[model samples]
Every structure is written in C-alpha cells, then in structure tokens.
Target: MSYQLTHPSLQHDRRILLSITKWLLIVGVSQAVQIRLSASERKRLRKIARGHRSPVREKLRAQIVGDAARGLPNTVIAHRCGVVEDTVRKWRGRFAADRLEGLKDLPRSGRPPSFTPVQVVEVKALACQIPADADVPLARWSCPELARHVVAAGVVESISTSTLRRWLTADAIKPWQYRSWIFPRDPDFAAKAGRVLDLYAGIWEGESLGVDEYVISSDEKTSIQARCRCHPSLPPGTARMMRINHDYERGGVLAYLAAYDIEGARVFGRCEPSTGIEPFMALVEQVMTQEPYVSAKRVFWVVDNGSSHRGKKAIERLTKRFSNAVMVHTPVHASWLNQIEIYFSVVQRKVVTPNDFTDLAEVEDRLLTFENRYNATARPFRWKFTRNDLDDLLTRIDRHQAAEPALTEAA
Candidate 1:
C-alpha cells in the first residue's frame, strides 16, 4: 500500500514563522498583494481559519488569504497571522496562482532510495534462500553478511548493511530467525485424534458417556536417568536459587509408566525396569483389578503407537483380559494428545529436574511416593482443545502444505 508522508514541521510552523518575523521585517520589502475569492470559498476559508482542530499551517494560510482578500497589505496580514511578511506574500501569490489547492503542501521528493528497484527486490528474495545455496558458508543471514553476498552475486555494486536492514525491515523479512515444523505422517491422523479429543470432552463416538465410564490416558516416560550430583544440592535461600553441580555420577535409569484417568483425575502408575507388553499388561491389571474399574460400565484406554499396546492385537488383548476395557491408540507421533504426558511433564519439572537421586531404588521411591502425593490433590487436566480447534489446525496445515512447492520453487 502507498501512503503520502506529511511534513511534521508544518504543524508547528507558526512558531517558527513567528520566531523569524523580526529578521524578515528588517529585510522585508513591500509588494502589492491582493486575492479575490468566491463567497463560498471565502466562507470555507473562514471556517478552516476559526476551526480549533485545523492544521496550524493551514489555519495560518487561511487567515492570511482571508486578510489579503479584505484588501489588507502584506505587512498587516503578516503581523496579524504572526508570520513573516514573505510568508503572507507567498500564500497570497499561491492562492492567486492555484486557489485552495495552492494552500496544500506540494508533494515532496524524499531522500532517493540507495539501491535500484531490482537490486532491492533481489536482496529481499535472497533473504528467503538458504545461505549455503549460494555457496556462502553460513547457516543463516545477518544484515552485513547478506549485504556482502548481494554485492558478490553482482546484484548490486556496493550496499551498506544498514541500508539492507532498512529494506528488509520495510518488508518484514528476517532471515536470522527460523522454526522447525513437520507434516503429519499418519494417514488416519484426524479421525484418530478426533476420537481421543471426543473422549476428553465426555463424548465417546457421538454419545455422552455414562458416569460409570472412564477415559484413561496412558504413556511410558522411558530412561529417567538418576544422575547423582558430585556435590550435594543446596536448598534455595533468600535471593538465591537451589544449585546443582554439573558434574555427576551416573546412578542408573528407569522407566515410569502411568495411566491418568481423564475425568476422575486419578493417576495409576508404577516404576518398571523397562517398557514392554508384559509390563504394560501388568499396569492394566493393577488399574482394572480395583473397585470402580472392575465394576464400571466401560473403561477406555488411550495409548500411543508403542509396541506394548499397538494394532488390533493390543485392542483384542485388552478386551479379552478385561471385558470393560477398550484400547484407543493415538495417531503415530501424536503422544502429545495423551493427558498422561501432562502428569509426566509435572514429574519431570518437580521431581526429576535436579536429578540428584542416590540410586535406582531412590528414583523408584520418589516416583511412587510422588504419585500418591499427587493423586491426593490432583484434578483432571482442563483440556480445551476440541474438534473445532483440530479442524482449524488441519486447515492451516493443508494451506501450508499446498503452498510448500510454490515456496520451494521461489527459493
């Protein structure tokens, strides 16, 4: 979009004009200055001149023109307007020459752009490309580096980094910043994800779930390392954070498998030696053998594409073991859809952050004890993402994927 730039100095020009009035008076020579206006034009000028919100320069110009039309001399109008005599004469001459349009500021030719149109376009386009593509040994583009490359590529004879910066900033082009993204690889991504989302929202397959039914999000946090700090960790004191030594002795690693009830907010988990079908089935037995799950109307188990519980076999296995249990697998690489990950994140931040465990036994105790303490006060995660949000996200992904080839070609 193109917009006209206004001169700000004109807003306060009356003050400047008044300040230099004495100098102009000493050197001022009188000239016959007269202007004639139609009755409507005179009314318009009077309205602009008396308006409180009129531009200062415009108000002064209107007042000068009105006085001149009243047969006043240049000096008298100048003094009345608090401007130099030459200022009055200039407006009077302009009004006679071009009427009201003459009162507006003429278009200004701003400082000419340093680079040619093609050079600027090429520079911005170059910013969109990988630096390595041009045989330049760079992972990203900085202003000075881009300027150097643009010159070397014969797009421009010479360019300053600041000039290049200004051009890129105008177009909001920043080559120094980057982000990582991936296309969804699961063929049944939306359908599978929507099913899990529906369970969280208390609707299973378009039907409201009964009070006795339950949705469980299960996941395994593997390789939780017990790194014993060489020196003991200090407790946080006033104005100081708790510190952990970087150097550490490798105590051991263990897997924490968890199943989080979405509605009831209860977490049933155990510290296992490793993750597999047998360990996972053991966890299922632990949860299903309990009072409510054993007698509930139905229990939906939400898990990811892990070997422990995957494919139709895992679903059949769960159903065979417990008639009430139903297995729901999240789409491949979509473990984030599982609410158990949220509980795992809390464990990571609160318990395993410093990782100052003495041994694998201490790790197991901490994990199991924290689980009990957590379930005492835990509330179900407030999952807000729904089918509508998923649809919007998929729409955006579709648009991005559709544009990728064109973007690649442009690059």
Candidate 2:
C-alpha cells in the first residue's frame, strides 16, 4: 500500500533519474528481451523496487524485473542496476520461466549443528557452576574458558569462543558478571521494616497521620573529606573532559547530619564534628525548634541502626528531650528504607562529587547552600512500596534460601 508521503517533492529527483535511464535505453535501438507483467504485478514490483527497507538483493531483483517488463535490454538493466549482464539475465530468465516465484532463493541445507541439545545443556550447567568447583582455578567463567572446559570434559570435542558466546547470549547467561547482596538476617526484619514503610506511607501504628503530625527520615553521612587539589582544575572543552589533579592535601573530615521531613518536603541539616549521640541530638533539637514541628502534635523520625540512633537508649534519649517526638529504627543493614539516605545520595552526586574543595569551610558552605537550593524545588517523594511488598520480598528470599542447600546437595 502506498503512503501519503511527508515530502513528495523529495521523490522527484529519484523519479527523474529513473526516467532518464529509461529514455536513454529506449533511444539506443537495441532489441530488448521482454517479460510481460500484469498491472498488479507491475505495481507490486515497483513498490518493492522503491521500498527503503527492502533487502538489497530483493530490491535489485525487483528493479531488474521491472526494467525487463518495460522492454529494456539486459545490458541497460545491468548498467543502471549495478550488476553484470549475466546477473540481470538470470533474474529475467527466471521471472519469464516461473513469474514471481522464481525471484526467491531456493532453500539449501545449512551446516550441521556442532553441538546437540544435551551437550548444550551440559555446557550451560558447567557455566553455572563455581570455577573452583570445576577445579579450573578461576573466579568466574569466560567464553574461552567455558569452551576449553567443555571440550576437555567431552561435552563437545571442539568449540569456539564465539559459538559459546552466541549460545550464552541467546539464553541471557552472563557467567562473567556478578553482583553482591545480602539475605535479610534479622529475625524481626519484616516487622521492623514494616513500621518504617508505614511511616513512609503516612501511616504509623495502623492509623493515618494527622494534619499537625509529620514523618521525618533522618541520618548522618560520616567522613566527608575536603581535598585541596595541588593544582587548579581544568575545565572541559572540545573532545576532552574536565581534569582535576589526583594529588591532594586533606583539609579535614566531618559528619553531616540531615533530617528530611517526608511529607513536608523540608530538609534540615548541620555539619558536625562527628557522628554520636550528642551530634544526633543536636540535629533533633534543630528540627524540633522549627515553627510547624515545634507545635506538631507528633513527629515520627525514621532512622537506620546507626550508633547515633541505635537501640532503646537512643529512643529514650530522643523522646525524653522532645515530648512530642517518636523514634523509629529501620532493620539492621537496611538503609534502603530510610528516605534520608535518598537525600544523602542526591548530595553525593550534586555537592560532594569531584570533591575539589579548598578546605572544610568551603565544603560546609557548599553543602548548606545546596540544602537551601534543594528545598526550594523539593517535593514529597512518591514511595509506593508497602508492607505487602515487604511480605512478597521476604517470601521470595525464603524460597530462594530454602532452595539453595537442596540445589547444592543435588549437584
């Protein structure tokens, strides 16, 4: 089917070229070998010849047929279509003998597969095994290594790295790459994490938050250092990137305590000497003294199990200072649940990255300036994961953990 071309004028030059080729062929007065074509067949062949995405060989065949149908000699067709006269003759004769069916290449038996299905399975299973278990003394498997191992094991007598790569790619198996993770180790992980998630969803103790109440995700980023470059940094230009000196003098390091009001879209922070009960309390005091929070009915603070806000003592210390405040700790090693860590990540990218500060003062100034700039545009983060998602996560982890030992024994 023909489309309404966006730029019909664009096709005018191509039309002119084809017309000129035809006209030059007609005036030469050489006897042409004619191939008759019905109107529908002629239109179909022209469409195929003009199609932008058509295969090169298929388009060439269509052009040869279309020109032959128009009574052009084999030499003219060959010259304009960029083929030898013998190439044009073959297609023209085939079209004359069998019409459109002759344009297709006849099927031929391809090379036999070098590996059978069972052998492929054996190779893949070997790939999934630890290199130490295979006694190959490698940290992971590469295509070449896998090929050699499989050949030595008689899974295949000989195999190429490319063949192994192709089979692995088709199944999306990459034995060379790995990622680090942890299974939830805390016995009360689900219950503890669920409470933090509830606060994120504006729920605590199974009730919606009140208008005067708030949720705060708080944490400390420790050991942020100020590195004074030995030389002035160079700016990026054409075909180059910004360069900074690797050698530097350490000005000092400090802890940054930050608290993000989850539903309020506000951030309160301060540079501390270090992270401890005292510095964290100072941060709590800074937030508690603010106008809305000072008068807030209840403020729930979500934090991870850091030394500053770890156990019952930290909770008792915080609540004793601010009567309206409530302390909630995320499960051990689970910083992902703390929304303040999200703000910390943003600071890591925008403020602390490259870290070419002259001194700790410059670092502190940059951080405080960024906090104000960030709050101007910050909105409440859309946190959708709930206790139900936590349940699904734990269930999946349980199934995977349960299967691991059995899988090992079976192996």
* Tens digit per residue, CA lDDT, model 2, 95-119: 8888888998989889997779998
Clashing pairs in 1: none
What digit string (tens of lDDT, one per residue) describes model 1 on residues 1-411?
A: 443334566646766787799667654534455588999999999999999999999998999999988888787887888989879888989999999999999999989976678888898999988999888999999999999888988999998888889999999999999987666799999999999999999898899999999988898999999888989999999999989899999987889999999888999989888899999999999999997999999999999999999999999999999999999989898888999999999999999887898999999999999999999999878888999999999999999889999978996
- Each candidate structure's TM-score, on Cα atoms with residue i matched to residue i, is 0.66, 0.79
Q: All candidates: CA RMSD in angstroms?
A: 13.8, 13.1
Window of ten residues with lowest summed lDDT in model 2: 1-10
